[model samples]
Each structure stands twice: as structure tokens, then as C-alpha cells.
Target chain A: MATILVHVMPKPEILDPQGKAVGAALPRLGFDGISQVRQGKRFELTVDGEVTDEVLANVRKAAETLLSNPVIEDVVQVKVVREGGCGCGGHGHGAGKAEKDLLA
Target chain B: MATILVHVMPKPEILDPQGKAVGAALPRLGFDGISQVRQGKRFELTVDGEVTDEVLANVRKAAETLLSNPVIEDVVQVKVVREGGCGCGGHGHGAGKAEKDLLA
Candidate 1:
């Protein structure tokens, strides 16, 4: 199976209050290096087979119609990720302690 | 000066209802390839300087304390993406139309 990652983030023109809250809270917690924060939604999709163009296209349609608010947000990216469990291209999953691979 | 992407996903044992909903809905919308869906949080942080270890460490602390439920969820991955506006190793941003970079 193929794992697809869909990242839906707010449009630049929209104000992200949750992100602002995180930014404000971080400084208070001593995470000083961050200048800004923007919050978003990530959907990890486990598909039935190889990640083909038609599969990606349908996922894109899902992103536009159901995943995000088209008026205020947009799908920033759609990625074909290596499945979970095996380190195909691990990304940073191998580096993290509690990482879970949905593909597994 | 740097853009760090922190992705927090539920631990494998944790139940992800939203992801299940998305997975269930997609097939109805004709996206038949998706077998399952896992929902998570994506935080785009614009930091003040280069993405050094010190910066990442503090962000890790933030992820542990403020961002996720340590008991149920985990930080699956963290990455430094090319800044918002520029195309340096653009990942998939260049391919999508509504993609927005917080660094810009």
C-alpha cells in the first residue's frame, strides 16, 4: 500500500488564532527562537496500492472539497510517503521515539 | 531565518476518529484507493535564526509540553523546510496552486 500525506493549512490572508496562541504560549514557556507559528491539519492516508497520478488527483479533490475550508484555507501539500514500520525513506520517523507508521 | 515543521500524530494505540471519518467519506466521494486515514497536527514555526540544535531542542520541549498529549500521542517527525517564498528544494509546494509559505 501507499501512504499519502495531505497537509491543509490556512490561507495567508486568513488569521490563525490557534497559531497565535501557540506562538504566544511558547515564549512564556521559554521557546524563544520561534518568530511565528501557523497551525494546520495533516491527514495520513493509507491507500490500497501504489501512489499513481489518478490516486493523487482524487486525494487532491478530497483536500479541496472535504479536508479544508476552501474560502479560508488550502492544501499546502500532498506527499507520497514511505510506508510506516519499514524505513523506506524514513523521513524523520526513525529519529522520533514515538513515531507510528499508519502503513503498518 | 528558519522554517521548522513539527508534526504531532497519535500514537498507534490511540484512536483517531477523525481520520477514520475521512477514510470513510473518501470512498463515498470516489476516492476508492484510500484504505484508512490518520489525523494529526502540523505546526509551521518561523524562527528567528538558523535552525540550530539549540532551537530544535527547545522546539522539542515545546512539542512535548504544549503541543501534544505525551501519554496518547507522540511527535512522529520534525523537519526544516525551505523557507516559505523561495523554491530551494521546494518539496511539493511548487506543484500545488494554493500552497502558502508562512516564511514569506
Candidate 2:
């Protein structure tokens, strides 16, 4: 199975109170250096088959349409993680570049 | 300035109602191929200086202590994005490996 990760972040112009609250709490809790924090949603979707381009397109559509509110958020990322690979490890550079192009 | 991306996901044993609702709605909305779905939080932290090892270490601590609930969530990723790089584009290889080692 291929796992797809979709990230939905608040638009730059939108206010992110949850993120602001965390940013405020961090300083109070002694975590320093961080000047800003934006909290966003991440979705991991386990697909039954290979993550073909069509599948990716569909996932992107779902990310934009169902996973995030276009009015206030942007689907910042949609990438596939290889099976058995740690979610953070398999960025799939080729896929990533292609997806970015598609987004552009 | 540097950006750190932290991903926190629900533990496998935990019940994620939000994810389940999205999963159930996908098929109804004509999006197919996804077998399972899990929702998580992604934090984009903008730091005022270079993301040194000390900064990463502190961020990891913050991620575990304040960004996520240890009982139900896992800080699956803590990686730095380069300044001027799109958040999705700067998963530094050496940094990623080091962070994974630190987590291990």
C-alpha cells in the first residue's frame, strides 16, 4: 500500500489563533528561538494500490475539496510515502517535483 | 531564518473520530482508492536564527512536551526547511537522518 500525505495550512492572510496560542505558550514553557508557529492539518491516506498519477490527482482534489477549506486554507502539500518507509523518509523526490509542477 | 516542520499523529491504538468521518465521507464523495485515513497535526515554526543542533533539540523537546500528547500522539517528524525554500522542498538529508537518530 502507498501512503499519501496531505497538508492543509491556513492561508497567509488568515488568522491562526490556535497557532498563536501555541506560540504564546511555548515561550512561557521555556522553548525559545521560535518566533512564529502555524498549526495545520495533516492527513495520511493509505491507498490500496500503486500511487499512480491519476490516484495522486484524485488525492489532490480530495485534499483541496474535502480536507481543507479553500476560503481560509491552502493545500500546501500532497505527496506519497513509500510502503514500509517511515513517513518522514520517503519524500520521493521525483514525485515531489512532479507534484509541485502540477500545482504550479 | 529557518523553518521547522513537526508532525504529530495519533497512536495506532487510539480511536480517531475525525479521521474516520473523513474516511467514510470519501467514498460518498466519489473519491476512491484510499483504504484508510488518519488525521494529524503539522506545525510550521519559524525561527529567528539558523536552525542549529541546539535549536532542533529544543524544538524536539517542545514537540514532545507541548505540541503533542505523549499518551495518544507521536511526534513522527522534526525537520528543518531552509530559508527561502518552500516548506515542502527543504527536507535536508543529513538533518533528517540526524533527527531520526535522535528520535531513535
- The candidate that wins on lDDT is 2
The chain B TM-scores of all candidates, as shown, are 0.75, 0.82
TM-scores of the models, in the order given: 0.79, 0.85
CA lDDT of every candidate = 0.69, 0.77
Among all windows of ten consecutive residues in candidate 2 chain B, which has the lowest summed lDDT?
B92-101
Give me the runs in candidate 1 sitting further than 4 Å from their true place: A82-104, B82-104
Candidate 1, residue B29: lDDT? 76
Tens-digit lDDT track of model 1 for A1-104: 65677777787678999999999999998789889998998777777766677777787788778888989886776666554421212333332122222211
| Pairs that collide, model 2 | none
Q: What lDDT is reached at residue A75 by model 1?
A: 76
Model 2 residue A63 lDDT?
Answer: 89
TM-score of chain B of 2: 0.82
